[model samples]
Target: MGLIVQKYGGTSVGTVERIMRVADRIIEYKNAGNDMVVVVSAMGKSTDVLIEMARQIAPNPSAREMDMLLTTGEQVSIALLAMALQQKGYDAVSLTGWQAGIATESVHGKARIQEVDTARIRSELQRGRIVIVAGFQGISEKGEITTLGRGGSDTTAVALAGSLRADKCEIFTDVSGVYTADPRVVPMAQKLDSISYDEMLELAILGAGVLHPRSVEAAKKYKVKLVVRSSFSQEEGTCVEEAADMETGRVVSGVAHDEDIAKITVVGMPARVGTLSRLFNTLAGAQINVDIIIQSSYDAAVTNISFTVSSDDLVRTLDTLAAYQEALGFDKVEHESGLAKVSIVGAGMITNPGVAAEMFQQLAEQDISIKMVSTSDIKVSCVIPAEQTSLAVRTLHTAFGLDVAEQAVVHGI
Candidate 1:
């Protein structure tokens, strides 16, 4: 029998009835003659509710304690799911990330997986038992519970699949699969049957929100076949595999938009070598992530450098840069919040030219002014006013022919 690893998001196992429903699906897979390993995230809104509770008690909670408190959400789901499976007459055991052998670095809030020792999981699978493991939480070498940042559950599932060499890794979530655009905003957005890992990574970064980029990287590195399906439906979901397996070469696969970005422009800096380095080094020291960097060298004497960072870090990033103002000798640092980043992703965009021009033209027709633009081989991103995000997404979705006539209803777990 083949080994299959499945991951259920918060919504899938949110309630007692939902947990039982998941158990039935797991049993169906087991009855099909496949050994199963399931990964579960925190129940719906449990983590957020816990975080709110923590905030009520303490304005600034310690990261260690916060992780300890937040991880309980997934623990609760694993136990409930295990109980549901056992009630159905199928043998099941729940294990925490640490118990399942997921080892990570010592970073408290945003730890990275160092390695996974699958001895316990392997032994349990060999015993003809369905193993349930908590996702998003892992143990550090110091024996502390650490989380893998946002979307850690996806990373955990992919990592487990890689370490176990499972036949497939199935990600069950609220959405059926990856779509050409968000269906809520673009009613005609078509579901992609297959996508390459690179395109998926770009889409994830651009706010497609189906799969985490880290998970995609892990799957690509380990060559694990990943499927995204709806927990509420039985229909076949999208498969993310290597590019060679895909037949179609559409220039645009999807449109993704993020409205949580702020642009910071360090204007009128000396154009001398290492000037920009000094400015960015300060931001790096403060642990801020900068995206979409653009530098214009007007003359040999001065340059205008601009970049984007999360809105949450706008103040901190500005303060950090301000601290180095004297050393870098810049004119001033200005920031614009309430900005959004909209991106178009496709695997075929690398070979196809004029895709960016068309994207810009469409946005212009809608009177959406683009503040900045960035392009990679497979993706194009533009920064615009946050208010124009929905309009821009709908426009781009229609421009790319993503609107479908009939909406596909998803089925099965």
Candidate 2:
């Protein structure tokens, strides 16, 4: 029998009823003669609640302690799911990240999976037990608990599937499948039947919430077959794999937007070979991820550099820059919140000309001012005001003909 790895997000196993429902689903898969490995996130909003508790205790708690506290959310999920399976008269076993042999780097809040020793998982499966693993967490070489950052459970499942060489890895979430754009923002967004790993990775990194970017990276690296679907329905899901030719079908695969963005500009900086490097190195040391960077030079001697970061990291980023402002010789540091990043992604864009021009033309026509811009072979991202995010998404969705027609249907199997 083939082995299948499935991951349920926080919302899928949010409540007692949902946990029981997930148990039933696992049982059904077992009856189909497949060895099952299930991974699950914490119950709905539990992680958030835990974070709130920590913040209440201390405004800036220790990252090591936070990791210790956050991993418990998935621990509760795994144990309860195991109990539900047993109540249904099925053999089941639950494993935490350490118990399942997931070894990670020592980074407390955002550890990366170093390797997965799957001997325990194999033993449990051989005993005719469904294996449920706590997602989003792992033990470090230092014997400390480390939690992967947000959406890390998705990475956990894909990494497990890769290590086990499972037949398929299914990601079950609240959304039915991957759409051309967020269905909440664009009602006409169509669900894709299938997508290339490159396109899906771009979408994930650009803010498509259906799957995690790290999971997509792992899947692509290991050639793992992935399916994304809704736990709430029986509908067929979107398959992610390598395509014969990425540019063969549609020119634009999807439009993704993130409203959780803030922009920072280092003004009146002397232009030098190491000035840019020094500025960014400081941010990297602070663990701030900079996106969509732009540099403008008014004269040969000085330049203005700007970049975007997640709004959550804005304060830390500013603080980091301020500490080094004198050393870096920057005159002033300015930042603005209430900004958004809008992006269009497709593998076909590599071969298609005018994709950027077309996107810019559409925004210009709508009087939506583009601030900073970044482009890769498959994607182009622009920073704009947060209030105009929905309008930009809708406008681009229609501009690229990504909007679904009335009575349109998604065909999948």
lDDT of 2 at 350: 83
For model 2, what is the alpha-carbon lDDT of residue 18? 94
Estimate the TM-score for candidate 1.
Answer: 0.94
Model 1 lDDT per residue over 1-413, tens place: 79999999988988898999999999999999999999999988899999999999998688899999999999999999999999989999999999999999988777889999999999998899999999998999999999997789999999999999999999999878998887766767788899988889889888777888789999999999999999998878999999989756588989998889999999899988898788888787676878899999888899999999989788778888888889889999888999999999988888899999999999999999999999999999999999999999999988987788987453422
In candidate 2, where is summed lDDT lowest over 10 consecutive residues?
A: 404-413
Instruction: List candidate 2 segments past 4 Å from native.
Output: 245-247, 406-413
Q: What TM-score does candidate 2 reach?
A: 0.95
Determine which window of 10 residues in candidate 1 has minimal summed lDDT.
404-413
Best by lDDT: 2
Candidate 2 lDDT over residue span 240-304, tens digit each: 98977334678899999999999898998999899989999989888788888889999989999
lDDT of each: 0.91, 0.92
